[model samples]
Target: MTEQQDIQLTFEEIVCACDNNIDWVVSVIEEEIISVHGKPQQASYSGFQLSRIRRAHRISRDFEASVPATALILQLLDELETLRKGG
Candidate 1:
């Protein structure tokens, strides 16, 4: 498979493992604004998108920023992934 295809497949796997409410997942992706190559970008996430969202939530919480519950959901999703990975 091509590299892009591999990435897409991997991302889908992550989303499935996320186990979050699908509607909330979609909202988080829609609301999140990210920078790619110094340009602002938006993402359309599948279930795997939760991994990145969760990471962002952790960083924000560590900095003591009050992220909303939807954001916190990502944090929980990440923790679940870590446990599943046995790391």
Candidate 2:
């Protein structure tokens, strides 16, 4: 029970925050780039997922990369974070 623990961003929120289309975000979801909570009829994202999505979105936009390429970059970044933690 802490900050960002239960902060669920709905599809509308995500679209607004990311300034992207619902269909595009839905494509990300369909690709399993990140998972969300809430009913099937009404999904919501967490801060962690939002951060990850932002990273991928940034990389995609900055480098004009494809979805799979963005995913690869995100995976590498996560690995870099893990290594930074001395784990």
Candidate 3:
């Protein structure tokens, strides 16, 4: 497999590792917890978004934030891609 293919496989692996629901994913994006540029920044994601989503889920689970878990999960996924692309 090529380097690009390996990266793609890694991304898929990360996505599969995420166990949160869609609702949680949305919250991550809405809360703006993770960003491509940095924190407190609104942006979109494109690559390695799955990894970010997983991280967001872990944070919410660990902190027990007031926001809905599902929403946060979605947001994390969305922002993750944007952050990964650095756009």
Q: For this target, which candidate reaches the highest lDDT against the unseen true structure? A: 2
How close to the true structure is residue 18 of candidate 2, measured as C-alpha lDDT? 59
**What is the C-alpha local distance difference test score of candidate 1?**
0.46
Segments in model 3 whose C-alpha atoms lie over 4 Å from true places:
1-3, 6-20, 32-47, 66-87
lDDT scores for all predictions? 0.46, 0.72, 0.52
For model 1, how does the per-residue alpha-carbon lDDT over 1-87 read when each residue is reduced to its tens digit? 665432332334433443533443344455552212221123333333444656654555466543455466655766899999998
Overlapping backbone residue pairs in candidate 1 total 3
Of 2 and 3, the candidate ranking higher by lDDT? 2
Candidate 2 yields a Cα-based lDDT of 0.72
Task: Enumerate residue pairs that collide in model 1.
Answer: 14-48, 15-47, 15-48
lDDT of 2 by residue, 1-87 (tens): 766445777777777655756766766666667765644228767887787777767887899887777777877887999999998
TM-score comparison, 1 vs 3, better candidate: 3
lDDT of 3 by residue, 1-87 (tens): 656631332323433554625455445545655344432123344456656566666666777755556455666667898999998
Worst 10 residues of 3 by lDDT: 5-14
At residue 81, candidate 2 shows an lDDT of: 93
Candidates ranked by lDDT: 2, 3, 1
